[model samples]
Target chain A: MDSVFVHKMWNDHELSKMINQDIPFLMLSDQDGSIGKMYGIYDEDSGVETRGRFIIDPDGNIQGFEVLTPPVGRNVSETIRQIKAFQLVRESQGTEATPSGWQPGKQTLKPGPDLVGNVWKVWKVSEAFND
Target chain B: MPEEFKPGCQRPPVKKIDPETAAGISNESVLKEAKPSMVKVGKPAPDFTAAAYGQGKFVNTSLSEYKGKWVLLCFYPGDFTFV
Candidate 1:
């Protein structure tokens, strides 16, 4: 857990150089690991939180999450893609489902009995890369 | 055995709480203490209010303030680490 001042300096020094701009979102400080403890990412031994991300939906329910160790870097774009998928499914009231590696303006499966075994035919691997 | 302390005489009356109602986990802090583990999917994301450094200034923010839109909480190990 970092103090707010440390978050400020990190953004100013390290993050800005990588992203070429100040991060335009909240870099919250979980001092004393209260929030991290709540999310189960707090590392008591290190006095820091492990790498993790949580996607909370509009209704405050946790829709998705990723918890990883320090060795691997988490992908922000992948999280964004999943968020888009989640929004699409929620918007369609769970009727539509984005398949693996689904992107916007691509085909979405209408989950039903008809598409149960026939998904292989309707969803082609080529389509994933076509558009 | 200590004779003066527990001589089986002049003892104060015991006070008791109802075990059913005062199971101790009924309070939220107790609940949090009991389950200091993972956040579950479809469960309400833990609400938090904290100071944040964002967009050139320090401001106080909370998870509940962003209730109407999607929220991504990114947590890393430390401030100056490269990963």
Candidate 2:
């Protein structure tokens, strides 16, 4: 897809009316798929990358990344949730790992203090946690 | 014509089909016929020195040079395709 064609589409009366403001965008090409392979997103069978997206911090640490299989679109809401969760953790004292199905404003158990007790309390029903 | 065809067609089937014997062979036994060499991860990746277009000229780049920063080496069947 050409940027010129996108710009032309955006300039149309119906499309222009939907946008209330301008957004900054960056476009980089992976001609030889060097970066794609580095991130482990390149698929050899299709000769194209799987639908993978990464949110890397300025310091080059991968804050979050998601690889969606073919025939599935990315979940924008989940990505935004991850970004917010990461930002919140960065702001707070960092001593916790988010459990499965974790959400904001939930009780985050600190790993160092009473890990066994916490695990028993959290997963009382699991057979692995029993003894 | 019938006598000529009968003489030409009369022969025992050399390849015999044994369903019971064939059924004895398990999936794992069949797969063990050939073994493939495995590459260990976390051990150093294979190094290759290739002529790369860098700094406005073609120069040789090796895996040993980029030891500190993570290096992503990719190989395509060929260039000019959307791989």
Candidate 3:
């Protein structure tokens, strides 16, 4: 939980230097931990929220969420990969399914009766970890 | 009486569970209850309106405003936390 001023300074001085550009998305300052509590990330004792990430789709439904401790860091590349995977699945109307570690322009599976037991034959372990 | 403090132990007996105190603490006590997240996949994310900083500007932002967009919402412990 930080203030808008803190967010501004952090973004300008720290985040920008690391990424070479400011974060392109809205960065809300949950000073009171109210927003964090709503998302179940607020720690009452620390008065801070756990590092959390939520991917909400266009329909406003939470597609994925992750909460991690201080020592471990979240992955932006993984986030982007999941976003693309979710988008592909949504656009295909659930027909296309992404395997673990799926990336854009990679192979997507068509989920149906044919794919029920033949996943191993078509998708290799190498392809999923190809990237 | 903890097993390690029962006596005949090689190391010094623990007097207190507090690490800061004279007794060296051990991870034996029950911690806080771990509650599951309220936000679930495929469920509607709770709407929130808060003061926000984005792209070098301070503004009031809300979850509802991004209705037709895919958002990768992130929350960290605090500012200057290198995470």
Collision pairs in model 2: none
lDDT digits (tens) for residues B30-61 of candidate 3 = 37446646878999999989998888788998
Predicted candidate 1 versus true structure: per-residue lDDT over A1-131, tens digit per residue: 67889988989989998999998788888888889998998766556677889999999999999988755778877898989999999999999999876889888999999998999987888766535
Give the Å error, residue B12, model 1: 51
DockQ head-to-head 2 vs 3, winner: 3
Q: Which stretches of candidate 3 lie over 4 Å from their true place?
A: B1-37
Compared with the true structure, all predictions reach lDDT values of: 0.82, 0.46, 0.80
lDDT of 3 by residue, A1-131 (tens): 77899888988888888889997776788887888888988766546677789999999999999998655788888888889889999999998999875788888899899989999988889885755
Name the top TM-score candidate: 3
CA displacement after TM-score superposition, residue B80 of candidate 1 (Å): 1.2
- Tens digit of lDDT per residue, candidate 2, span A50-130? 555665433334555566654456666667656666666655657765554555665555677678666767643433221
Backbone collision count in every prediction? Answer: 0, 0, 0
Candidates in descending lDDT order: 1, 3, 2
Give the DockQ of candidate 2. Answer: 0.02
DockQ of each: 0.30, 0.02, 0.35
